[model samples]
Target: MKVNNSNLDFDSNATDSESERAAVAPVVCLENIHKQFGSLEVLKGIDLKASAGEVISLIGSSGSGKSTLLRCANLLEVPQDGEIIFEGEPIIWSGSGFSRKPSDNDQVRKLRTNLSMVFQQFNLWAHLTILENVIEAPVTVLGRDPLQSAAFGLELLEKVGIGDKSDAYPSQLSGGQQQRAAIARALAMEPRAILFDEPTSALDPELEAEVVRVIKSLADEGRTMIIVTHDMKLAREVANQSIFLHQGLIEEQGDPEELFGNPKSERLQQFLSATASV
Candidate 1:
């Protein structure tokens, strides 16, 4: 039904309802975040929040630190400064600045499991079948029963529209298929939120549409997601809060319609203008 549709349609009054839901508490919150690699600063004094069922899109040019911000939220890359709070718990940290890291291994692991990341590249195991790839982490890391995990993994694969390919190796699938498999893997975690880093960038236009369709279905189901994307249209369509990042800082942010249609910052306006032509 809804999942099979190519076009995404949202209720006209969803904004009001979503706002009410978001007022409870953010699932993930970042305050005054700062990240740097060597001497090159990536994210500078950034603040972000993702409440349950709210979709946030990070959009900017290359080197704008959108992906870096996502990584910090997922703890794939620890920020040199800032508080990373998940579901009301602040990440325990040790040291300061460049030397800072998460102090509690258990906390990091717990948070990581609750925030699943789907990367730009498929990142699937070539040797494992699609179903195995989907169930591997759940069965091993989460200690789920193998038979039950396999059944749920198959359901997730079907949800992503690749049930027929469950026994296929990643090498046998197209870029879009592999990415869908990755999405299934992320879903298998039953995470509180999903972090997407340029999820459609690796596929060609036709194949990209396939992945986009699945993402739209997820958005329709009100999945909490933070997406770093170059696809302006997808950002506008799926994101409730659209943030425009420039040179490692937030240039502007607001409702996607207002931010995209009536950008306040000149930088954001210019960025939209440039991306519109591509």
Candidate 2:
């Protein structure tokens, strides 16, 4: 749990020695994160760390604050209390309690670019082609050349097994295809880590398998990721670390194998049984 300051800044293009040192530090760290909507508390004093090439899965029942925790990681939803650190740099805040918000827009923007989020709903632009959806942010936000972005976008789409449907819009694709396109779009950012919020929940079992395969492939590639999912099978299969939340706090967490097969917490055992019956 000790974070090394020497590994604070990570550069993919760094020398081998630097990369080795950087691998020890977390790409993202959340400390004592607390969030509440009006009077309803969602997260309470949560702490999480994701190092390079680490896949962490958050599994719990609905209202356990899984989605809110993901949003807070990229500053999509600011926590009223706690620290959000990216590459060891703490986020600057402007106010206290309910009015608290990130103080610097530029810093938030920089961090967000490295933390790509894939929503459960596949929030793609219906008017744009699949390829366009993948390249838009890289071109507009990062100022990359449109031509090169399109080329890379196509490569990403191909990687996601949707090269033939690059010209199709979100409305024209099946839910599985659309989700794959969304995954490709997330890859287009070349993010340090990808955050998946129930990426497979929107699809039927057959369609869900498609996304699961892609996610498992990413894990095999050593991609740093945090997944919030209801599918215990996917969590057990792909995650290096698995965490179970109950009433806004981590009830139990550890290696996926032990967590799933020999869960010590009664709540997690109950949860696994219920999901199994579903």
* Local accuracy of candidate 1 as per-residue lDDT tens digits, 140-169: 999999999999999999899999999999
RMSD of each: 4.6, 4.7
Instruction: Return the TM-score for candidate 2, rounded to 2 decimals.
Output: 0.92
| Alpha-carbon local distance difference test for all models | 0.89, 0.89
Error of 2 at 182 (Å): 0.4
Per-residue lDDT tens digits of candidate 2, residues 64-130? 9989999999999989999999988999999989999999999999899999999999999889999
Off by over 4 Å in 1: 1-24
Compute the lDDT for candidate 1.
Answer: 0.89
Clashes of each: 0, 0
